[model samples]
Target: MSFEYYYITVVSLVIFIVALVIAIIMNSRYYKVIREYLVQARGAEAKGQAMSGEVEVLACPRCGYSTTIPFRVGDYVGKVVGETCPKDGERLVVVAIYSLRPTEYQGS
Candidate 1:
């Protein structure tokens, strides 16, 4: 082949190699960012589960009898629970819902 053709071929091969290297570097960076984000998201989810829980305070309207129980799904303040009070056979109502974590309202 002519010297011109050989030079052109060499330049083209070099350009292709440079483009391939750039693509690999960019892909590696993208994957690293995605991996870090996923790790952070998982850690946050686990921390949330470990840190907070809810409890329901049930009270009898008639007798002023109150008790605490683990909060169930769909339980809300003012909701009537299926269980009745031991004192007066009155239907118990959810008087309050609070988290297990200590907050500003809870004094030291």
Candidate 2:
């Protein structure tokens, strides 16, 4: 082969190798990020499961409207008193009254 042809072939091979290396590095980084996110999600799910065991169901004292809200072990959920009820248009005070067993966590 001519010198020009040999040089072109060598340059093409070098470019191909460089491109392959770059693609591999980028894919590895992408995989790493995906793995990290999955790990974090699993950890969050476990924590949520532990927390779901302790829930508080609150009811409006004036109107008897009720809702279940999540409560952590050391945290307190504040009550909103004298708030207007969406259903009955009456002023109500919310009071924490009960707890339920754990449920599955639905990630948002």
Candidate 3:
């Protein structure tokens, strides 16, 4: 009957709204946890930890002018990406990689 169909539709609408509200609340809580974690990590960095950075050596094959760039994600030695050489305006190559480790602090 028409009345039975109308009742089911109303119940379904209410259930959908409830699910949407719960999902939004869960998403907000997840982001709040992530923000807290980042805050803690930044505090650790301020205490002189995580100061060293990775170094990259990129060289030009045409003119032999090498460049150093801080290594990041998706960058590695010997993988040629589209980067122009600053010295000779030629295609550059990643020649070497190194990690810049900070020296131990002396209790002076």
Ranking, lDDT, top scorer first: 1, 3, 2
Please tell me which model should have the higher TM-score, number 2 or number 3. Answer: 2
Q: Which window of 10 residues has the lowest lDDT sum in candidate 3?
A: 43-52
What is candidate 1's lDDT per residue for 1-108, written digit by digit as tens? 999999999999999999999999999999999999998898577546544677678999999999777668998899999989988899999999877875745676
Residues 28-104 of candidate 2 have per-residue lDDT tens digits of 99999999999889857755754546555546655688645455354344555444666776654435533445233
Which runs in model 3 stand beyond 4 Å of their true positions? 1-51, 102-108
Residues 1-108, model 3: lDDT tens digits: 699999999999999999999999999999999999997777576433324666677899888988666675787778885779867778888998776664433353
Q: Which clashing pairs does model 3 show?
A: none
- Per-residue error for 45 in candidate 2, Å, reads 1.1
After superposition on all C-alphas, the RMSD of every candidate to the true structure, in Å, is 15.6, 13.0, 10.2
Instruction: List the candidate 2 regions with Cα displacement exceeding 4 Å.
Output: 54-108
Q: Which prediction has more favorable lDDT, 1 or 2? A: 1
- State the lDDT at 16 in candidate 3: 100
Q: What lDDT would each prediction earn against the true structure?
A: 0.85, 0.64, 0.77
> Best by TM-score, which number?
2
TM-score of 2: 0.48
